[model samples]
Target: MSTHRILIAGFGGQGVQFAGRLLAHVGMYVGKEVSYLSSYGPEMRGGTSNCSVQISDKFIASPLVLEPTELVVMNGPSLEKFEKTVVPGGRIYIDSSIVAKPAVRSDIEPHPIPATALAEEMGLGRLANVIFCGYLIKKLDLCPLSALPAILKEVVSAKRPELLEGNLQALALGFSM
Candidate 1:
């Protein structure tokens, strides 16, 4: 069985763990073995946060991920911290709004998307993480687009039902890009 490990890192409010949870849920819904682990600094909103997710066709050996197959970084600090931990030939997705500098590695492919700027334009600036999720799914063929609506709906909060449409829109916009 093959396992695909993903790492997502960003500031505390960037929804790094949320994006990781989405991927892990999608993987499980598709019948794959999945594990997710999240870590963050004690500084709360502005502090660093990250999550590791592993999806596999067989039982997962561990939840920890030291070298990821793909890395999603939403800020300059995150990029600097996690860039070297990606495996050679791995893929890295950077939020161009916060990460202006490009990765120095030649072996990995880099995708720089202006997530925050685009989300602000959509009147949902906080949905940047959802946008990144859409981009990652589309770029990596992680899951079917048709599966997102149901899963998203299921996971979204009952009190914040209005955000679901915005999240869907953000996801579609990112996928189109």
Candidate 2:
């Protein structure tokens, strides 16, 4: 009901930027105020990367999120970097297969999702961030379920209709977890 800020972090090429973009696009589709931003340096895929998306029923004033309602980390480094900054009672999603440890605090809820593994199982290894997005959506309850399939269909490959199905499967899997 209130503004929701989300931070998606990982090494570059992990689809963190795309994840944020997709969420922002979905927010736009639903007639919500949305902002998306990403960081890209020389290191790119091998180095740290971050993307933030803010969606709200009211106006969205900024794209940066130093404190987010939810945080999604694709690797250990991102998990560590954002763990301390997540707002209290916030949700954090980690790729459990890649990130072994969790935050020292217990107040912040952490969802350990084997997103990469699930994507691999679904034959779409490139969709790890999308899978994580599904989990983040499920955990945060930020958007309507009815809008998700439409979201994937709009943002993902139309050429590979199979991918849209796989992404939906991944989204459902995330919700189930």
Candidate 3:
């Protein structure tokens, strides 16, 4: 991929910012120029949250993703708000468990993954965002699955060492899907 302008949107507790940060870290880990910008509503847990991530081989001019090449929406409201912001032929990854309605845009390709459901089933409901991140990495061929352990180690080792194994399992689950 030359340049990927990714937009991830969802409710605050859905880990939208974490997902975007994970993607940006992956981009950085793979030696790409990366930028991440996050926005959230006033409320902490249930408010609107979204992030813009840019990964490019060249210099990135802006962090704002007005028209994203890849869109990930975790809830129905997010889908409704940002569905029209994806560029034509761009790919959208929807959390099918939360977003019951299908995307209305015909120009963009939509991938409906039951991320939240699968995470819940696996007893890792809060890691749905990581699951989606894994699927995104697999689907986009952004990086090798073998590289994730190291990445996850770096991400969770400092403060959340107990979460490493669960996160790994969640990533594997999503990748296999």
Total clashing pairs for each candidate? 0, 0, 0
RMSD of each: 1.9, 2.1, 1.7
List candidate 1 stretches off by more than 4 Å: 40-46
* Per-residue error (Å), model 3, residue 105: 1.2
Supply the TM-score for candidate 1.
0.92
Query: Candidate 1 clashing pairs?
Result: none
Sorted on TM-score, best first, the list reads 3, 1, 2
**Which candidate do you rate higher for lDDT, 1 or 3?**
3
- Global CA lDDT of candidate 3, please? 0.88
**Candidate 3 deviation (Cα RMSD):** 1.7
What lDDT tens digits, residue by residue, belong to model 2 across residues 82-117? 898889999888888788886676889878888888
| Global lDDT of each candidate | 0.85, 0.81, 0.88
For model 1, residues 16-110, the per-residue Cα lDDT tens digits are 88889988887888888999998744634558888999988888887988899889999889888899999999989999888889989999998
lDDT of 3 by residue, 84-113 (tens): 989999999999998999999888998999
Error of 3 at 136 (Å): 0.7
lDDT of model 1, residue 113:
90
Query: Which candidate wins on lDDT?
Result: 3
